[model samples]
Target: MRIKVWITSTVIATIGVAAWAHTGATGVVLERMQGMSAMGESIKTLTPMMRGQVPYDADLVRREADAMVGHSGEQMARLFPEGSGGGVSKALPSVWEDSEQFAALAEDLKTAAEGLKLSAGNGLATAQSNDSGSMMGGTTGGMMGGGASSMMGGGMMESNQVMTGEMFANMPADAAFTMVAQTCSACHQKFRKEDE
Candidate 1:
């Protein structure tokens, strides 16, 4: 009877540990999924703006940018496992081992995204007046196709054009693609499976 009881307890303990591990893995997977979904949505929102299919809306841009920045920060922290010695992420232990550096990059992305949102809120005049270049520049809509003009069916304006209602009123779109892209690139380079 003593032996049987001991065996039973051992089995139970093993099961509990297995359950806990599964739960942790699920949390990690879920975080990745949510982060990817948010980025996809941001791209969709920015499509129209990049293509010049619709004029930029300050409110929509700000809302989407805020979401992207917030999610990026939250996801970064969640990514590191509880005590895998800090950086046991599929991202190669280097990330967790040097957490401070990883965190700084994440913060950089958040700040740049926030700046983009602020610029968007100020409207077209702000976009044109400031020749400092985009807070997250590199041709936002090019992922979809040719330059903005081709994508918008010839409605595309010069990069410096003062965005107007006539250009984007019909289509309400957000401008958070570049920001999201940066986060994705950073994560993929540091953590995700390169072969994937």
Candidate 2:
């Protein structure tokens, strides 16, 4: 009986974790959540390399960037319908209210992801050079691919716009990774609701 109880307890704990991860979300909201989770996982996989905590593998970076871009732009936005934020969703109402702006942000995300993929192929130096100035001085949209320009001080574009000079020649890959991550943060800050 003691062994049975322990097994039951373990099962319950596993179920609890699964439920918490889903957060009672359903339908399109659930789909979006799962998509976001996938993106986060891909980023997590690349973080160590980006941080130089692990050796940088150009092939791995390119593969992960492709994973991220798969869900970007129109493909990602389509998952969020007009009223899909109804069931335990973390999405804000503004998603439907200001959809055009949201669409633009999605495009920016796509651009950033594409740029990262290309940059990884080109070498860390090239990626750092292309992304540095744009991350700092570009519009807020450039960062988040969501329309929260105010959060970032102003609107910015995606990392696709290259900086052609000696300015970022010495910048590191970690900085480039941070800039890319910031773009995701910018949108989440504006569009996602904090857990209660």
Candidate 3:
């Protein structure tokens, strides 16, 4: 139940944050925004499955994970070439100033999505199991922020620090999804411009 509410709320918040239109965006910025929106929609598709509102299909989970995997890593990195910022872009200057960290976070997203692909069944299994204890713990702001939310303004990524691929290597699909979400949050909080 905690997981369901958290995931839904997070996704919703992310989309809400990204409610800002891409008005005036051009070139790579627009491309990245579209990519992020697509990812958000993918996550939205999985939300029901994640919450057990819909039946979980391993194939569907893997396919969605593939979508996330496809949009990330180098494909994601290229969206932020040196001069792509400014004008309608909400990207903060830190993206270029802290290039290495920014790029590493992008790679982390790829790694987390891969883990999600590998652990497709485990996500819904855990969701359906009613296991005890706090899976989300400190993740208050949560889930959706960055992937699409960040790309679109990255969504409301939580305050949880980034997790390493090694850490996510054997996690359940739900947990791996969190890893991806947190990475998105971390990047956007650090890099994206605030909605104000």
Candidate 4:
């Protein structure tokens, strides 16, 4: 049930991005938004499998994890430079105000993605233990991909425009995935602006 809610929320958020484009947003601002959007799509692909709504495929899981790993860590941190906040940006002042913690969170995400890849390759999937529900029918549509329309400066994107922890010791994949997501949540809660 919890995974269901998370998946629903992520999907809803990503769907909104589809119609919203980077109008004035260009350069690295747009680049990071697109990176976040891509990461979100990768997480979306894994959720169904994590939910057991779809069959477990190690190859697919590893691929998505790799995609996430690509956008995170130093890669993610480089997108934000000094004086890149405000305007259409959704980033809060703390990103620049508290750069160290933000960078830690980014590194944490990369580490988590790497852990997920390792777990998947080692045959640790939710499908292995029947923790997932029955295979869900049909497919979700219209996730064309966009982000917080018309941003003028460089900044961070929504976490859901991208994509939790040790309570998930049951499966290795689950554990790694939760850790990866927790990093995202932590970064968003502290760095990203609320949708006011």
lDDT of 2 at 179: 44
Model 4 TM-score (2 dp): 0.70
Q: Comparing 1 and 4 by TM-score, which wins?
A: 4
TM-score, every prediction: 0.50, 0.65, 0.71, 0.70
Number of the candidate with higher lDDT, 1 or 2: 2
Please, what are the lDDT tens digits per residue for candidate 4 over residues 1-196? 1222133343336435632645577778788878877877787777767666777787897899999999999999999998887775666899898999888789877866876787674333323433443221111111112211111011123232222222122224644565555557667778876553
Error of 3 at 182 (Å): 1.1
Per-residue CA lDDT of candidate 1, range 1-196, in tens? 0000001222223223332323344456546445545644655565456444578676777777777677655455666664543222244566677677666656545654565565564344224324355432333333233332232332221122333333333111223233334444554466443321
Model 4 spans > 4 angstroms off:
1-15, 18-21, 122-171
Tens digit per residue, CA lDDT, model 3, 55-76: 8787887898899888888888
lDDT of candidate 2 at residue 172, scale 0 to 100: 35
Number of the top lDDT candidate: 3
- Give one digit per residue, the lDDT tens place, for model 2 in 33-78: 7777766766677765654567778788778778878877898899
Two-way lDDT contest, 1 vs 4, winner: 4
Best by TM-score: 3
Consecutive 10-residue window with the lowest summed lDDT within model 2: 1-10
Which 10 residues in a row give candidate 3 its minimum summed lDDT? 147-156
